[model samples]
Target: MDSPICLIENLNGTLSVNEQAIDYLMGLEQKIVVVAIVGLYRTGKSYLMNKLARSKTGFALGGTIQSKTKGIWMWRVDHPAKADRAIILLDTEGLGDVEKGDSKSDAWIFALSILLSSTLIYNSRGTIDNDAVEKLQPNRYVTELTELIKVKASSGASSADDEEGSGSQFVQFFPNFVWVVRDFTLQLELNGKDIDADQYLENSLKLKKGFGKNISDYNMTRDCIRNFFPTRKCFVFPFPATVEKMQLLDTLEDKQLSKKFSSTADTFCRFIYENSPVKTILGGKTLTGRMLGHLINTYVATINSGNVPCLENAILAMAELENQAALEDAFVMYKKEMEVVKALFPVDSSHLSENHLKSQTRSTHAFMERSLKDTDGKYSAILAGKIKEYANNLFEENQDASEKKCKALLDKLSATMDHGVKEGTYSTPGGYELYCDHHDTLMARYRAEPNKGVKAEEVLEQFLKEKSAESSSILQADIKLTENEKHIQAEKNKTSQMAQEKAALDERH
Candidate 1:
């Protein structure tokens, strides 16, 4: 009901919200196919799309000469015949409208539609003729495609085989070009025999040109469409209703309208439905919901930069951008989870604190690694791997910071524990149990991450080595001091006894 996402601004030439569109597309979980219509302004293109969509109120149908579809408009719908596919219907701004003359902008809209569609209908209002055919496939339009390939090739945007001006590049995206002649005044029967639309189209194609200088260009242009287009389909619809009837359908209500307007173009609708491929892309890829913006940006950027759009080059661009998008999404997810892990670190500045930091760092890095490795669509393995490389760097960087925290914690704990042992508060080995208790508490928390537990144990062992060295040195000095004190006490006792004995003997004499 609300207008579909406008891919391009018809007059301003701005492409909008492509990333949102691309994301929406990838989430569809269904294969995407496209059907599009392109023609001169006021040729019933919008109404045709409305019919194709099997809806009456959705796509706007203009009553006046002004074009209703100002830019490229798209509607996503379920494929009529296939359950596994989604069909994207595109209604383009008409070319050669009175409001906007046939300018370079018109050419871009025309070319872009052709590039994006799987089944492209070229709508015209009159009988098919040399002039009609020529107008439909203008020399400029054909040459513009070639010229674009030229620019793409010259700019080295395309590879060797698919260079600009090469048939391979331009022809790769050529849709099944259907020439739908809306009003046929001429006879379908020639000399009392039935003639199919294809036969009639061939007659127009085979018509010889009148004498004119440089008419060769016209001939060549026609021939190019005939020769290079992968497939050609032709259909001629009898004039649907009178001009008065058509205008009433535009200007008046059903009660205000004639019954002639109510006559449905049933056979025409059926033809379109039946002719529509089950999956328009069939075996080839063109229109998919996610790739829409990439395709538009690829061409729009090239055209806006005053260059030409090439198919393979566009594909390459899509690959790079989509990969980058996935990488960015993964980082966002990783950072959010890392924040949660960081909050799990111990608050107190104690022996257990270093283990918390180590565990947190391990958790953060594991979160990132898992995010980087998980991908959909095979997403440029090289670029995805580059992101993995970045995660590895983060791991190393966090380890360095956590290791510093661990060493500082150990040094501070060593001083406090050492004082307790020397001051007769505990036995020398008594503090060992307390320190090991702290280590065990944090180590148990990291059991899910076994490497983290191992790392914490190593840090504890290193701290013990420093503490053991200081304790062993002090204990050895205490042993020597105690032995000397005992020997001096024994000698003093002997000296006192000898002095007492000598005094007694002298008194007796």
Candidate 2:
């Protein structure tokens, strides 16, 4: 069983900087979707998180409400219903802790939760009312957090998200918000109609203003909630257990806690595991283990330095880094593949063949293309576009390498041409048979390569011309030998007739 990595301690504004933590997150082979909890302090937020994580003793459920969670804690656990993905449980410090004394900290906590989570569970005690919605003034902090967190934006646009043209850029980072109400003792029927939680929320949001409040930043707290979480959902849980009853238990698995709240908790957990999709950050990446450390650093550094985090920009920075790393890895593998292709060529010319080399090169190239496309990750269109460019460069690099090797083989053939010709091995009806055989071999070897250097055509033409000239010289020498032998035979026949006449005269005497 794998454990969770404490990504950040907000109390001191320190992220977990250890490589072990970084490696553990990076090592996750599954897609990650985060489910985070945030509401008023001691609202059983950590305990609920334990249920989701399926851990009896994790995330430290605070008994006395001095705020158990300081900054943010994340644990990677297998999704109960998803075999292909994992859930990153983000347990946040609760809001409205007076001893903390800073409303700004509360705002930062919410911002961080929204930034990191896919499905944010807004856990609160008692019935859902105007006050609960008012406390979560999502519309109020658009300008404040950008400066407080100090994230380096994608465009490097110094202007905030509220700056006229940046709205779309900023809005892409909002989370899917789920408002989970606890201990709701009110009736579902209103005026002879049965209303579910969604209808109840819509009716509550229908009013533009709440009693005694002008809705500070936006039209009203209700409007802000509606606008902020466009893809919103609501869950109402019966009082899981009394605060006094919960404090004494060691874990959610305790018989008393389970007996009272098991059914409601089971339903909530089922919704999370079955319904939540893998959350993508900035449309380019999921909040995976590999990227967790960098995000933590960005958030912690921005908040600690008193710079409001502009998440859109921070995401841009992370994606650029992620894409670069992915490309470099692909590039290395591409080179190794070419190395294998080069080895397929025979070391000496004895086993040289043309078509096989071409076939192998084409196969290797096709494999490279497919592999590069698979590297198209979270930032699909943009990262894939960049990968295409890198792949082109790789294709050219491999082609150039093939041409170099082909020229080297041709050079070896040229050196041996003089020796083979001098031995008259090239003179025959089928002139230069050895050279022709090797030529076919050379052509086959580079059949899959482009003619970038020392083209096969140019080498073949020069070789044939040289072989023809050598054969012509051999033919002229044979002609001279025949003419000289005929002249010698004529002289020998005349000398033989003279000798026969002398022998006849001697016999008559």
For candidate 1, lDDT tens digit of each residue in 1-509? 24456656665654343455556666664666667888888888877776677676566788787888887888777666778777777888887666765467777777877777777888888887667776765436654566544324335544424554445545555666777787666778767899988777766666256757567755655665765475777777665566767754434443553343233345555655556553322225434455566667778788778867766577667756655565566545555554454454322233234443454455445433322222353543543464456545545545555555565555554565556556744433344455455445434433333223213545667765766775565566556656777888889988988988999999999
C-alpha TM-score for every candidate: 0.60, 0.68
**Model 1, C-alpha of 283: deviation from truth (Å):** 13
Please provide the root mean square deviation of candidate 1 (C-alpha atoms, Å). 9.0
Per-residue lDDT value at 405 in model 2: 62
The number of clashing residue pairs in each candidate reads 1, 20
Best by TM-score: 2
RMSD of every candidate to native, in Å, equals 9.0, 7.7
lDDT leader = 2
Tens digits of per-residue lDDT, candidate 2, 164-280, equal 233334446667777888777777666889998767666666755555545443344554455556777777777656757767555444556644357767777888887776877
lDDT of 2 at 354: 40
Worst 10 residues of 1 by lDDT: 445-454
